[model samples]
Target: MNVNPVELHEVSFAYNGTEVLRQVTLTVRPGEFLAVIGPNGGGKTTLLKIILGLLRPSEGTVTVLGTDPVSARAQIGYVPQRSAHERDFPISVWDTVLMGRLGRRAFRLSYHSDDEDAAREALRAVEMLDYQDRQIGRLSEGQRQRVFVARALAGRPRLLLMDEPTASVDVVMQAGIYQLLQKIKQDLTIVLVTHDIGVIASYVDKIACLGGEMFYHDSKEIGQKDLEKMYDCPVELIAHGVPHRVVREHRHD
Candidate 1:
């Protein structure tokens, strides 16, 4: 039988005796695109860390790929928030993407032909094969974001986790990145932590609102009541640069 790509059962995390996440339980199925959105300091990144095994929960159980996180590391790929320093790093795109192979297998002194093929395929997936030899620093922010995604894809992970992949790009570029994800979601299970609630509805299959607790009904259709509870205010949901109803008509209170 197939197992879920991610499972968290009553997971709670605390730092210095302060609670960050409480009883957060979630399940991500194979080939599903899920978006985690909430206010800052809501433990979105912390939840990803728990799934990645970077941080153990203070309470409850976590499973990734039906096994312990560390053991399942090879099947997971991560794309961190873009950094300005990364843009100026003096490295070729090819080398950057090849680094993804480091996580999939035992450490090797040099990349083999298989590694090269994987990197090439990943670059092609993101349409960045032509820029393989170019300096990463010379590419546009959107292009650089694609390279980062390619780096993650090179690992051939069944589960991909991204943190604000479009944070550095403009709205148009953000749409482009989401479009790319839409194309690739058929083959991978994606759990993305983002603040872009507007554009996410058009791309992701489901949404989870995290704010020390998870408010998800296992569907992408979230109501204004849930949004207000998550954001602590009335929210006007937007999609495609226009007002969109995720669940019900907006109430003029």
Candidate 2:
């Protein structure tokens, strides 16, 4: 039987005596591409961290791939939010991608041939194999993002979690990144945290609006009421006359 890729029941997390998440329950099924959207400081990253086993919830249970997050971490690939200084790192793309295979190998002396093959296949999947030898710092933001994705894929994860993967790229590059994801979504379950509501409807299979609480309609379509509750204000989801009505316009009488 196929197990759910992620399951969290009444999950709550707090940092430094302040609660960031409160009784948020969610389930991501196999082969699902779910996007988590919410305002800043709304525990979006915290949720991802908890799911990755990097942080333990203060309350409730968390399960990933039919097991605890830490036990199932080997099958999970994570692409964290990009940092400004990361672009200046003195590492080659090939080396960066190989880092994903760090804990998966037999001996820690050096990377095995299997690791090299995985890294190569991952670079090819992201269409970055030609630039594998190049310095990571020399690539464009979009290209760098692709390399990071390749690094994640090198681990051969069944569940992929991305945190704001396209935050720094231009509009066109953003589309390209989404298109790449579309090609790979058939093989992996994806959970992405994004503020780019305008493009999510076209790509993701479902939408989860998360604030301190979880407001999910169990479909890609999100109602105006859900958006309002997520943002804690009236939201106008006008996307320059785009037909996708993720959140309806707020009209004044």
Candidate 3:
């Protein structure tokens, strides 16, 4: 039997007595692209933080790779969604990609041949290898997102966690980023927290619709009914392929 890469047992959390996650139990198979979709303040980010050891569960245990997140920190890579538009932070695309290998690189300081090879491969995977010398600030929103992904890829992660990677980019760039995610998903177990349910239908393996309650549903057969229950509004189904999505008055909730 294949062991689950992530296991959350009876996990519960809260901030100042308001419950965030209650008795939340979940498991992720190795190399599964599980997207966590939910409304605001629904504990989506909290769940990722718990899995990453950034937040401790108030009621249960989380085992990542058979160990606590703190102990297995190096096994997972995270690409957080944040704008790189701040001024005066000097970082190159090459350096940003290199940062992902820092855990192992910390011991070596000098990157070995294999490290360079992996970085190059990851950059190539994201189609940004040629722009290695460009300053991160100089790149467009899409390019910067790819660079961040390249950084996460450098970690050689068994599992990758991302949050709203396309939120900062435009509509055209969002599609490109989703396609890039599709390619990368084949290599690692990906857990993405996103609000765009439409863009997700083609790439992600499964949809975990989080609402007033947490619901993990199949990506296939996601019709108007499934969406209405999740969003509590009328919706229309739009099919592209395996990842079908809903078109509602309010799509993102």
Best by lDDT: 2
How would you encode candidate 2's per-residue C-alpha lDDT over 160-195 as one tens digit per residue? 999998898998999899899989888799999987
Steric clash pairs (candidate 2): none
- Using all chains and alpha carbons, the TM-scores for the candidates as numbered come to 0.93, 0.94, 0.87
The count of residue-pair clashes in candidate 3 stands at 1
Any runs in candidate 1 off by more than 4 Å, and if so which? 239-253
Worst 10 contiguous positions by lDDT, candidate 2? 238-247
- For residues 1-253, what per-residue lDDT tens digits would candidate 1 score against the true structure? 2799999999999989999999999999988999999888899999999999999999999999999999988888899887788877889999999989987555667788999999999999999999999999999999999999999999999999999888868989998999999887777999999876767887887889998899875777676777777776556666432234444445546
Q: lDDT value for candidate 3? A: 0.79
Give every collision pair in model 3: 201-243
**How many clashes (backbone N, Cα, C below 3 Å) per candidate?**
0, 0, 1
Q: What TM-score does candidate 3 reach?
A: 0.87
> Between 1 and 2, whose TM-score is larger?
2
C-alpha lDDT values of all predictions: 0.87, 0.88, 0.79
Candidate 1 lDDT score at position 63: 93
Q: Model 3, poorest ten-residue lDDT window?
A: 243-252
Deviation (Å) of 224 in candidate 1 = 1.7
